[model samples]
Structure formats: structure tokens, C-alpha cells
Target: MPQITMSAPMSKFSSFNVHDDFVYKNVDGVAIKTAILVPKSLKPGKKAPVLVHMHGGGFMTGNRLFEPWFALWFMQWAESVGAVIVSPDHRLLPESSSEDMADDIVDFWSWVHTDLSAEVSRVTSGATQVDLENIAVGGESAGQYSFRAQLSITNHEIGGFLSVLSALTCPNAKIKAVVCQYGPLDYEVPWFTQPNHQRSIMGAPPAEPGKPEAVIQDYLTRYVDVEKIAVRTESRVEELWPLCVAYAHAGKLAEALGRSDKVMPMRLIEKAESLPPIWFVHGSGDTIVNPDCTMNFVNKVKKLLPQTPMHVSMEPGEHGFDGGVPLDEKWVQDGLSQTAAMSSKPGEQFEVRQTSTTEDYTPDPSKSLPLSPERQALVDDILALYSCQPTIRRVERYTADCVYDDQFVYANDRYKMAGQWFALPKFFKESKNERYEIIKNDRDLIQFKNEQSWTFKLIPKTATINAIVSLSLDPDTVDSDFIQVKYHKDQANDKDYSHNGFGFQFKKFQADNVVKLMSSDEVKYFEKDKHAAKEPVKKYGTGDETGQAPKQDF
Candidate 1:
């Protein structure tokens, strides 16, 4: 019922033609989409630069057009810079985790490069075009981490997202500038970890008789397990705001994001070799997310990219104070100017180009190492098994008594294997990238790697199964050479991510010691072998965050 269709809250940008629900990609069969605003002046042949923005809903709830939190200045920037606007809705939390968000980011940028142009042209009847080569990213409150900042609260708090972006190998597209609204950038600070009884912007923290912690559990059960895309997530702030307040009140904002050392995200400032131009907007009177979030992040980023344009639009207001300010206001004009300047001359060394020469690239499964028809057929069947394709029954992929084992899943016989595979849909939304890089090929042996993405329906998050698998075929059974999957003396695993190969066995042992310290009663409740219960390995924040009960600042 919570659909994020376009609503024109800002009247100034009415000149631009808007298109909603451009399906960029699909995750777990759910369509992840973006809302686009193309300037009417953007001619069909002449490419216009692009700006992709993330919306803010305190992270707990808000759709893409959650107009209440829209950064009004984004419109000015689009007009001044002559950029087409693309706003996307990503998986949101208390129900979702930082790991799922990371995938969304990767897939988003991947979509921007591969499919954005065609989508734009199709929507506009080829009257509008997007310049992926010239691009910028910005976001408000929860959106800040989507662009820059150490994400902490309701919280599009994309904890340590910049590090992920920096590691990506996207050479074709250039990240021109970063616009950050009043984002809760530093989660490591006390303001984030401590309870704020006083109202800042969102609303007054929940008063007594409201057990937010308990309410969180009820809402978790009441709401959709995981709203894959933000807009599709029907968010009634009235109902969910308590969970946001409670999360902060209990100093559990850190817990909601999982444990990550990067909540502060200053490591990026210390090690980043080169960064694009950045701008900041924060109100001095801000309380919910202290002004320090912007000042601290800007200060650190300024030090890292001192020559780069590190513009700030500081003023006197609270979080999201300028959402509806008129464009004629001096402060509003000043803020808009700062962003426009960044968009124009993005960096001291960066070149401002309206076009790009690099060819667009999208992932191709067929581009992997080539194999003869027989070898390829064997590889295809093996992948079907990895993806747990139910229709692979007649494919003769796995033996009836195949030894399939994993940390949380155990399926040896075909019956148990089928049950485990079938239960996957029940427990998690499954998506697979069958891209494989064959490592070895022989008369009876084949090895390759496959990464399977899972969004757990119950736990409401994601996990990637990167299984480097090797299958041995009985040379004597030439007919089933490719179809035969056998257990090797040391190469068989039911675990998607190998404990033996990836050094998780040590962590498992360490976890075992901690489990040993727990009382019998506590141990009884913890499910050691349920994939739903297992913590994802890559979720952001410091794992060292200690758990505690509520401590109201009131």
C-alpha cells in the first residue's frame, strides 16, 4: 500500500518533465526503481549531466517522495547545473541492514551506467538524454550517508559507504560533486550513542508507557519483513516514529546498523588519495543530529581534499530546517550558489566536461572464460545447482546421496537438499549472479566461483553466498561427465562461504568460546545453525558495540 509515486511539493521545478518507476534492477524479484526529472530544455541529441539523489526518512521510514524531508535546494542545483535528476528508493532499516544497502548502492551505480540512458530516452520519446559521464550525487538526512558522511541514525546511515565506492572499478563515470544535507555523519560521537530527551526536529522522544523496545518487536512482526525499495515501503511515520525514537533512546542506533568501526567514517579522510568536490549544509541549532555531524565530516574531508571545493552552507536552524524555505531568501540563495559552484567547477584538478568518451559497460555472464560445448554444459548445470533451481530435477546436477553441508544448512541426501533449497524461498529472497570465472578444467574436474545474493525474509536483511566450487566427475562414467557432482576428499562443502578457504573457522572458534560463556538458558534460545540467525560478515559499524538497555536523557 505504501507506493512512492511522484508528488510536486516544490513548485519552482514544475518546468521539468518527471518520470516515475524506471525499473533499474530487480532484487529478490522485487523491482528497485528511480524517479527521474528531466529538464525540458535538455534536447534529445544534446546530453545533459545527471544528479542522483537519496531521500531522508530518519532511516526508519519515508518513501522517495517523502516530501517532508526533501532538500529544497536540490531543485536549484538541477536548474543551475542543467542536470537531470534521478532519485532512487533503497532498502530501509530497523528491518534492513547496512549490508543490504551496500548491494543497493553497487547495483544502483551499475544501473546508472548500463541502463539509465535508454530509460530516459524511452520515457521522453528520445527528447531527453542523460550524461552519465558527467554525474553528481547528493542526499538529505538519511540520504547523507548515501552520498557522504558517517551514517548513524533513521538513518540512511550508509555506514562507511564511501569506502565501498572508492573500491569500485567504475572508470567510465565520474563522480563530480557530493551534496550532503544535515546528515548524522558521525555515529561514533556521544550524540548518536546517547539518548536525547529534548526534541530536535523529527519529534519529541517517546515518553513513558511507550516501551519503544517492545514496540520495535511488535512493528517488526507487523510490517512487511523487508521493504526492498524505499518507495514501495509503506511508511506511516506516526506508527514508526516511536521505533526511531526508541532506537536512539536505548543507544541502539549503533545496534540497528550492526557493529562497524566506520560509523565515524574518519578513516576515509585519513587514507583517501583523491576525492571530488564536496558541499555541506547544516543548521547551528540542530539537535537530533548535532551540527557537529556536518562540521566534523566537512572538517575531516576538507583536510583530505583541501584544494577541492569543500563548501558549507551553515545557518541557524535545526535538522531539516530549510526544507521549505523560499529560494529568494538570502540564506537559501547562498546555499544554492554553493552547490551550483561545486557542480560547475567540481574540483581544482578536475575537468568540467559535459560529455564522456568511455564506452558503457555492463556485466556479461557469457564474457567469462570460454569452454567447449561439453565443458560449458557441465558448468551450466553446476550453476543451476548453486542457484538451487528447482526445475533442475531432470538436469542430473546433484547425486541423490550428494554430501551437501553448510554452517547453518545441512542437506546430504537429495530429499534434504531439495528441502533446504526449497526452504530458501520461504526464508530469503534469492537472486543469483551466475558470472563465473573458471579456475580449472580437466577430463573429470571443473572449478568456478558463483556469488548468490539472499535477502532473508524472516531476519529482513541480505547475505551473499560466494562458493568456490569444484566438482569431480567419474572418468569411467563418460555419459554423465559434466552432470556428475561428487564430494572430494577435502573439497566438499555445504557452506556457501567456505570456513576452510576464507579463514572464518578461526572466527567460528572465537564465537564458540563466547557461546561457551553464555548461561544454559541463553544458549537454549540462540539458534547456532539457522542462517537467519547468523550475523552477516560484511554489515557496517564496529562489531565491538556493547549492548545495553534504555537510558533516557529526559
Candidate 2:
């Protein structure tokens, strides 16, 4: 067992008292350090739930305090929700594999259950003040992956990717829930295998095996013996070669990598049938670990355990929702509130502050004249129609416009248009014309130049004359070629728009098309539907003798 060390001294906050220490003599004889965060104020004879949290960093980097932001926020939540949090500093990569990390957690759980039986009883009995049955496990990134391994063992699966099989199979049946933040579920998925796994295994191209420039070989040489490095290199060929072949043949190498037979079988999910309920938090714009990972797992779980409670929150941002990212505070609170609600007993009280507000304001006629009754009614009608729609208005720039001459427009090989967009002009200017910036802030100026003026037509289905025609520009100068579009729809529009009655109608058209490109899926749907020609006629009910329907219009 590895020895435990606490570098930072424990500090007491208003809501919680944080203590850092090591848990020695782990099950695998590896000593690991852990941190315990206990809520400071608790009512006498009242026990709080326990949450075991793991941090992210792809399982390779990260410590018990890997993400201090989440730690602080979670501590605040624990105080408000009355929960106890335990975060352990597990063994990391290069020194250990993900299995080793999972084993460390299992060992810690055992120690908490058996070795510290007195403390456990004290906490549960409200002497030390911690709830026993309401235990939950959670983590972010690689920590999340390891947490899944723990869940897998609790559900009983043997021998696959990592060596934690022996440790995981011993059921710690007390755990109530599991939460993952942007964790990778399917290791065999192409998104996880190809490019990513390959790069991690063999390093990048132009740095071949046994060569001085080979990064993979260098990394291996630093970590393992020559014999082990040779074995790992050979193993890479055995694992990734078939994956590459599948990718070439199916155009779905990512999905292929995720297939159960390729790496870790998808049957693991089935084995996890009796597992506790799960909560998944992912960023909508996450590219590192595709949101598809969560979507696929959730879909499979829903089929296997329809009654198992699962809540997924898609934040309007990208991976690493800790700091410096646009995270939804409301979404986080809602998730915490849900967790608290689920953990509480029948009559137990759990209070979460809801900050959503509705405004009631009177229009000022002095600043702007009030509209006529008829105009006001028209405005009301428009608002009523769009009230259910999810509208997002943000400034974005037109980075490229591909247009061809009349003769070349019909030519198969004729160039259409393709260009890059950036988030800031300062980056473009700093890059010295190598790249152009798109939209960073609303205050930033946009530049648009006509590389070739082309006619564009956009017709709405509801109204034939509701068409938009604009002169699209092409890339001429790096910094001087940008146009601002006030509104852009994210991929979730279909899901959000479903409430507005338009989402289901447009759902089929949203597939395989980037939000910016319309001619692909957009044109295909347009050609099939032909707008108003397929519109359903509105039916009106007969009115009563009083000249109104039995159900009067509000």
C-alpha cells in the first residue's frame, strides 16, 4: 500500500470544515491520501447524507483536490443540503492504471465501512452526524471513468479492460446513487479509440516506432522497461490496426471503436442492471468527450431499467465546466436540488433557493408612444405564437461564402466555397494573416467583402413571401472578411423547439446537417415537402346561436 500525505492544512469555512489526510494500508497494499469535507453546523440527532466525489484529469492527472472550484461549490451545497463529502487522492497514471485508481476507492470504502466501524456508527447514529444509507459516488472526467468501474463491480461484471475486476465484484450495496460529469462511457467507441486511443498508444504520426522522434516510444521508455515498451508497441498494432481497417470500410470508425466486442463489451451495461440511479451532467458543446457518450449510455440504460431514475443536464458550454467556462448556474443548482430531493426521506425537509423571476412592468408612453389596440393585438398574436419557442440571439460572423460562376455552378468539380472562422480578431491579427477571426464579442466590428456576389433565397413555410435574400460575401482579406448574424440556432433547437410545435416538424431535417449549412439536410427536406403545398388546413368548430363556440375563447 502507498503512504498517504496531506499537503494543504485543513481549513474551516462557514458551512463546512475541510480536513486533508491519507488512508494507509489499502486493499491492494497501496497507500492513498483522501480529503474529508464535513458540514460544520448540524442539528442534534440529525444525520446527513454522504457523497464520495472524484476529480477529473483523464484519470492520469488530478488529485483529491483536482478541481477546487467544484470542491468549494459542492461543500456549499453539502452545507445547504446537509450532506458529508469525502474526496480521495488516488494513484494516477504512469504510476498506475484506471483500475488501480478504482481499487483504491473500493479499498477506502471498505475501510470506511469496517475499519472505521465505530466512526461509521457514530456518524449514522447522529453522534458524529452522517447518514449511512444515503451514500453516493461521483466524479468528473477520468475520475468519472473510475467511478463507473466501481459501479460496474457493484453490479457484478468480471475481467475486461482494467484489473479492478476482483475488487469491484465485492458489492458495497449501501451506495444509493452515482453521478458523472462529462465521463467517457464506451471505451470501444471510435471517438474514444481511433485518433485519441491511437495517439495515446502510438503517439502522433511522423514519429514512428523505434525512431528518435517517436513520442509514444519516448513516453514508454520513460515509464517502462525496454521489454515492456516493445510489448506495448506490438499490442498497439494488434488493437488499433483492426480499428483503422473498420474505419476505412464503414465511415463509422468512431462508432466501431465503441462497439462492445472491440474493447470493453457493451454487455457491461446489462450486468449493471441493479445499479443505483444515475445523474449525468454534460456540456452541449463538449468535443473532447462527445455528448453522444452520455446519450448512448442513457438510451441503453433506459431500455434496461426503465424505472431507474436518471437525470441528464446539457449545459450550454463545453467540457471542463469547472472554471473559465460558460456554465449554467441554474442547471447546477437544479441538479443539486434534484439529488437532495431524491436522497431525502419521506417527511424530511430539503430547501433549495429558486431564483427564477417573472417580470411585471408597465410601458412608459412618455419615452415611446403606446401602440394602437389593433397593433397591440397583432403584437400579442406574434408573441403567443413564439412564446413556446426557444430563441437564442448572439452575434456571430460570416466567415466564408462559396459561390461559382453561372457556367461552373452546374459543374461537378466547380469550387463552391470553404473558409475558417475565429473567435477574435486579435488572434487573427496576432497570427499575422495565417488565420482570420469570426465573432468574439458584440462590440467587435465585422468585415465582409464580396469574393463573388451570389443570389440566396430563404423562404419560410408559413408564408410564401416571407423570404430573405442577402448578398453573401467571400473571403478576400483575413481581417476584412466577416459579417454578423444576430441569431444562430444550436443543435438542441429541435429538442427545445419541440414545445413550440415546430421542433417535431423540423426534427427529421436537423440530421446530418451542420447548423450553418442549409443545402445539405435543409435542401433535402425542402425538396421533399415543397412548403405550403403540404400545409395542413386549419379546422374551425361550429359556433353556438350566441355567435361563439360552447368553449369561449379567452
Candidate 3:
């Protein structure tokens, strides 16, 4: 990514001055750039509320800077609410997974109010004073999930990112309000089955093997290298971008099934007691992200938490309706006034309006199970492989084979001999640093992560893969017994995205100690400072050459 620069305190509009990359904060070993907008009418030394907006791009593309449309919208919002607006350039996928991005957002939130408020005031030379107590967080599309994550599971420590700031640091600190615009709150909803829907919860097309291009199906489960696995796009996403996206949603789905600590806002409808007042805006004609997702979430919140101030407004338009529609200053001012009145008081009035009911919908469970615990577990485990910190370190680093299922059926059965599958594994053993324990069974989750590292071997080289499973499991799967596992890998060279993960199941399972499951040679390999013996690269032949590849039925 190129460095984006802008003049400090430059006037972008008549009502406010914009400052880009005000103070870069290190989040999860990655620096997060933030932009601040201060209203021109605000007097120095007088504290004003702040609105933090998380930009949306399906977690694949987007930034914090204001676009042309956002500029006018921000100008109106600031003038109406009498607040300063801050946007953080949260990290994106392929390089940083959703879990990593969530960590950055949480850290950004904690730092802004807990650490950067004073700096912000001093840097502006007291021109703008931020009222940390009245901070509000909002987002659209993928960005909305970040707010949901923070609200529902912020107190729980999940990954290494928690080392800097635990969600419990300021338990009493609460978000004043939220603005959700056309967000995808439910993954299991039939909203994806609509005629114009571009993507399902699993993700958009080209994710399915052979949908547009013929690919080695198992590769989707094994490794994430786009060089080894080709997508239909010519973009910069060389690493397994699609898998990263699918896995992130999977983790949320698992959390929704009550099988993980990850938070999915729609799943927390019954636990809306702690949520802040919210104003939801959606387009009745929007098909990009089902407007019904937001409605469903709001309706559930209204039913479960009647005291929580809530409002919903729908217009006749498509996704990103605001971008095309010109903003009316009077309407924005009135809306903000109503928001303020409702914030100070509770449930004064609720609003819901729409031009058409054609797009209004509720998901049907007959088409699919509302939630699949097994698939969710697989996704949660994959995410953990990328985000979880090791509880114990037995060595500095090592490359070893940790296999999941040797005879793993590829659902598509692309290969005749299933035992020939393999993936590369590089383990970086680091010392335990912080006391971050958000999930009680996180150790078990980590164990699954280790096993997922093994499943990466099953993928075929230079082939894209996609897998969607419908099997469900008990939410109490955390206590399931472990099974024997083996691993095979080439030498390690600090490669992180080399291992892609897949979902698999063992028919006969039994519990075994970690020490007993790992061979002494493998443990010795971990302790070795020098590179271990180089394993000969395995040769793979096409179906025409060896007649081992499964026939393409589709």
C-alpha cells in the first residue's frame, strides 16, 4: 500500500477542517492510520462528542479517508450533531484476517479514548476537545461486524492482539450510540438466495470450484497461495483472499451457534441488555447486502430489549443509496436532533419507514439449517491458526508434518489416492506474554488450530478450492476427545500464509496427551537450531498422465 498524505487542518468543506493520519497507533504489530475532522464552529476548551466510523469494503477493500460522497455526508453530520468525526484505516484481509482487523479496531478504540484523547486535544492546540464519555461507533457492510464484535465479546481475550489492550480495561466505558447502514447481520439468512444477490454467507462466486474455472478442489482446504491457487480476478490478492473471507464468516457462524466466543450481532439479540441505542438505515431496494438483515436485527433487539432506544429508516433505492442521493442539510439536522433527544432519554419514539415491502423479508430455515456447528467450528479453528497465541513454547521455531486426515474425502473426490495429500507447516514458538483469556476452552480451540495446520496439505498445487458443509454438531463439542494426528512439511522460511485450512471429521475419536501424540523426533526437530533434513518435493500428475484425478462431473 502507498503512503496517503494530506494537509493538516485543511478545509474540505465550509463547516469542518480535515486532518489525515493524525496519529498512527500500533495495533497488533501493525500501524493503524486515523483521520480526524473537527467542526469549525466548535470553540476551544469546550468538549464535544466524537463519532467513529468504520469504513466498509466486505473486509477486502476500503479505507478511512472520506470519499466525495462521504465528505458531504460528514459535513452535514458534524454540523448537525456538533461532534468531531474520526476514521481509522483498519487492516484488511489476505494479509490480515478479520480477527486481526477486529483486534486493530478494538485497540484503536481503547487508545483513542484511554490514551490518545489528551494527545488529540494537545495536537489540535486545544481547538478541539473530545468527549470520550460520549463516543459512538458505527459502520456499514463488513465494518458493522467490528462494532458487533466489540459490543458483545469485547471483554473476552481471543488472540495475541489482546496483549496491548484487553476489552475489560474499561468495562464501565460504553458506546453512546451506533449507526448501522445496510449491514449483513445474519449469515444463515436466505437473503443470499435472491435473484440479484451477489454473495452468500460463504462468499461470492469463483469461490466454488469450477464455477468459472476448473480448479483442484482440495487446494481450497490446504494452502492459501494464489500462485498455487488461482482466482478469476487479476487483482493484487495473491494470497488466499477468498478463503480468508469465508473463514471469517465461518467463525462468526460458529459463535452464533453458541460454540465459540466470537460475536455475531444478530445472534446476540437475546443478550441486548448491554447494547447501546442504535439508529439503523437501509434501502428497501438494496440487494447487495440484504436490508432485511438489518431489519431482522433491529426487530429482535426491539423485542428483547424494549428499553434500548432504536430507530429504523428505509428509502426506495439500492445498495449505497446515499452515494447517489444528494444530502438535504435540513433532514440531517432534524435527524440528528431526534437522535440526541432519544440518546438522553430512552425509548421515547421508534421509527420505521419504507417505500416498498417487496424487499422486506425473513429467512426460511427449510432451504438450509439456520446454523451449522461443524462448519462454524472448522472456520473458528482456521481463524485461530492465524490469530491465536501459543500458550506454551517448546522451541524457537520448526517445520513439521501435523496431518489431519490422510484419507480425507475431497467432497468432490478429485484425487484417486487420498493418502498422497500434504501441506507445508511452519511453527513459530513464542513465549506466553499476557493474561488474555476470553474463551475458557481456548486451549482446546488452539489444539484444533494445530490440527487445521495439518489439513493444508490436502490441497492441489495451482488449483482453487471451495468447500461448503451442511453437517451440524453439538455445541458441547469443546469436550470432544482428540484423535491421532501426523504431519509432513518442507523446510520453514518464516512463511505465514503458506498453510490454508479445511474442514474434516474423524469417525473413531479418542483422547490423547499432546506429548504422546507428538513424536520425540518431532519435538527434537522443534529444538534444532539448524534447518532439519529437507524432504523431497512430492510429484503430482494430472488425470491424463496418471489416471488418478477424479473425473469432472460438473
> Which one is best on TM-score?
1
Q: lDDT of model 3 at residue 261?
A: 26
lDDT for each residue of candidate 1 in 225-288, tens digit (9 for 90 to 100): 5544232332654555556667666556666766544333455456666666666767787656
lDDT of 2 by residue, 112-184 (tens): 6664435544444535555566676776422121232221101001011221121123356376666666656
- Greater-lDDT candidate between 1 and 3: 1
lDDT of each: 0.51, 0.36, 0.38
Worst 10 residues of 2 by lDDT: 410-419
lDDT of 3: 0.38
Residue 462 accuracy (lDDT) in model 1: 71
TM-score of 1: 0.52
- TM-score of model 2 relative to the true fold? 0.45
lDDT minimum window of 10 residues, candidate 1: 346-355
On lDDT, who's better, 2 or 3? 3
* Rank by lDDT (best first): 1, 3, 2
